[model samples]
Target: MSPVAAPAAGPSATPSADRVADVRALSDHLPRFFRLVQALKQAAGVDGRDRAALVLLFPLVRVGPLRQSALAELVHADPSTVSRHVAALVEQGLVQRVADETDGRATRLLVTDAGRAAAERLREERTAHLAAVTAGWSDDDLAVLTELFGRLLDDLTAALPADSRPAFPAPREKP
Candidate 1:
């Protein structure tokens, strides 16, 4: 089997022209990646929730309870849109509303046991799908892809303004 080709040099390693091309390539590819993942999720049955609702469940599962406003910011969605998603999730018994421990007047959304189960199933299905797709990939290639993607996510998160950043746990430091 042929080895996978390395990605083009990124901004730090490339000339300005190459960097611009690389950035443009990334911009062009991200939407395709998003659509592919969305399609995969849809095929995985997504627990009967719409994509937006399932997306909201992820942050809640990963980061624990959050205020609706905070969840909206984390998902980079409008508060009203998130509110609608939350309402649907709540109605499905996948999410619950709880009073904020720190604020008497405020409420937070928590995932239900059923929600956690669904999230776990979704994760497993996605992992299986990815594994099947990459079944021919070598371990080193998979490692490199995982490392680069994690770095990209960390860099993107860091580039956001401090106040605009999500309330999720901080990225881990490389040893």
Candidate 2:
């Protein structure tokens, strides 16, 4: 096996060297983060079917009912993929199609009572799990992490082409 060489920095990289290093660090940690999240989800007793339904359930629960296309935009997923997830959710009685109030001809996806219950349970369990993981961290450390992560997401969103950008809700002001 041969060691990989880092890419040579170019003119465009002048001002972003530190940011590039940060991105590399994030890339290295993401797999571990994802594995931990998956383990937590599994421990929460979220069955595969219901776990898959979370793709649709999350947005529906957060933003209220939305047209399929809008849900796709929010999740940064393909419309067809969202459709498939929505179909599974509907079959599991987690979500339902509702008439769009503003446009009668359009249908929106809404989470059912059962779906809300499942989502809340999963959310609570995840929160508890994360709290345990970060229990030793001080309040200031946690606050810094939250602020930096939000900033990273905002910067990434801004870098995307306008048409390719996802529809994230505006950030809420801290009380």
TM-score, per-candidate, Cα-based? 0.76, 0.71
Candidate closest to the true structure, highest lDDT:
1
Return the TM-score for candidate 1, rounded to 2 decimals.
0.76
Model 1 clashing residue pairs (backbone): none
Candidate 1, residues 1-175, lDDT tens digits: the string is 2233465586467555655676788899999999987776667665535766866788998888999998888878888888988998899899999999999999999999999887787668777878898899998887878777887888898998998777785444453
The per-prediction CA RMSD against the true structure, in angstroms, equals: 4.5, 6.3
Clashes of 2: 0
User: Per-residue lDDT for 4-50 in model 2, tens only?
Assistant: 23544865666456656766878989889889878866776868556
Quickly count the clashes in candidate 1: 0
